[model samples]
Target: MPNRLALKRKSAYLAQLGRCYYCGLPMWQDDLDSFSRAHNIKPSQAKPLKCTAEHLEARQDGGLDTAQNIVAACWSCNQRRHKRKKAPAPDAYLDLVQQRVRKGRWHCAPLLTAFGALFAGHDSGGEATS
Candidate 1:
C-alpha cells in the first residue's frame, strides 16, 4: 500500500521541480500524474517498506518519500532507477532548493519606494498632501 504522505510528497516534489531530473525537461501534467514515489534511503530488513502500484525498489528499501528524497522521472528512468541499489545523490535536491530560492528573489521596487518615502515629503497618510 502507498502511504498518503508519500503520494502527497511525490506530487509536491514533482510540481516544485517542474521537470524530470534524468531527462532535464519539463514534465507534462499527464506525465507528472504518472510519477511514482521513490525512496532515497532504504529501510531495514526488520521494517520493510510498503510498495506502490507502478513499481517497487527492493534495494532502495523505500525510506525516501519526502520532497528531498524524490525526483520527477519518466517511465524509462524510473525503471532504470529501480534496478539500482542506492538512492540518487543530493545534487538534484540541492539544485531544486537553490532554484526555489532564486525564484523568490526580492523585488527592490517596493523597498525603494519605502526608503524614498523616508527621505521625501509626505503626509500622515503617506501621500503628498498638497
Candidate 2:
C-alpha cells in the first residue's frame, strides 16, 4: 500500500525525470505532457516483480513509498521488468534514490515515511510497535 502524498511526490519526481530510467523512452507526466521514468531493471528480467508487481526494487520490498528507495523510471522500462525475482544492487538502488531526491525532495520523503509507518501500524508516534 502507498500513501497519497508519497504517490503525489513520486509522480512529481517522475514528472521531473523527463524520461524512463529503464527503456530510456519518453513518458507522460500529465497526459498532455510527454515524459517517462524507465525502470532501472525490467521486472520481467528481474524476479522481484513476482511479489511486488512493480519494476522498482525498493518498491518491490516496500521501498517505493520511501523516497529514499524510489527512482525516476519510464513506463515501458518499468513494464518490461515484470515477474522476475531479485532487486537491483544496493549501490544501484541508492544511486537512483539519490538521483530522484537531487531536486530537494528529501524533506518530503521523511514525511511520507512517517505517514506510511503510522498508517501501516509500524510507528504510532511512540504509541508502541506491534
Candidate 3:
C-alpha cells in the first residue's frame, strides 16, 4: 500500500491538474531518471521540476497531512519557500511566485526553453502558443 502522505500528494497533484500550486508550472511525477530521459537532460538538471507535496502550514508548525493542508508543488518552488530563514505563508509565497512567474524569473531560461517546452507545453512567461 502507498503511504498516506504519498496518496495525499498524488491526490493534490491530480486535483491541481499536474501543475505546481505555487508557480503554476507543470510538475513531473516520475523518478529523476525518467524525467531526465524524457527531457534529454541529466538527472541533476531534472530536479527543479520534480513534483513534491508541500504543506501549507509546515509540519514543524503543527500542520497535519490532510488534503486541505497539502498541495502539489515543483521541487524548485517547494525548496524556494522552505529555504528562507522564516518561510513565508503559503498565500504570500504564492503571490511572490506568481510575480516571479509573470516576470519569467522563476525558472532559468534554459530550463523553460528546453524542459518546459517539452513537458510544461507553455511559453516561459505565459500560455502555450501555436
- Highest TM-score against the true fold, candidate: 3
Candidate order by decreasing lDDT: 3, 2, 1
- Best-to-worst order by TM-score is 3, 2, 1
Q: Report the C-alpha lDDT of model 1 over 1-130, residue by residue, as the tens digit.
A: 7576557535743553443343232233332223222211222210111122122223246644455455444343345445456644435433543343234322123322322333234321123435
RMSD of each: 18.5, 15.1, 4.0
**TM-scores for all candidates?**
0.33, 0.36, 0.79
Model 3 bad stretches (over 4 Å): 36-43, 114-130
lDDT of 3 by residue, 1-130 (tens): 9899999999988887777888776678867787678767667766788889999999999999999999899989999999999999998998898777666687887665664433344432234547
Query: What RMSD value applies to candidate 2?
Result: 15.1
For candidate 2, write residues 1-130 as lDDT tens digits: 7766447545544543433333222234343211111333332322211211122444545554544445455443344334236555645643554444344342234333332332333211122346
> Considering TM-score, which of the candidate structures 2 and 3 is the better prediction for this target?
3
The C-alpha stretches of model 2 lying farther than 4 A from their native spots are 1-16, 32-55, 60-64, 85-130
* Residue 57 accuracy (lDDT) in model 2: 44
Q: Count the backbone clashes (under 3 Å) in each candidate.
A: 0, 26, 0
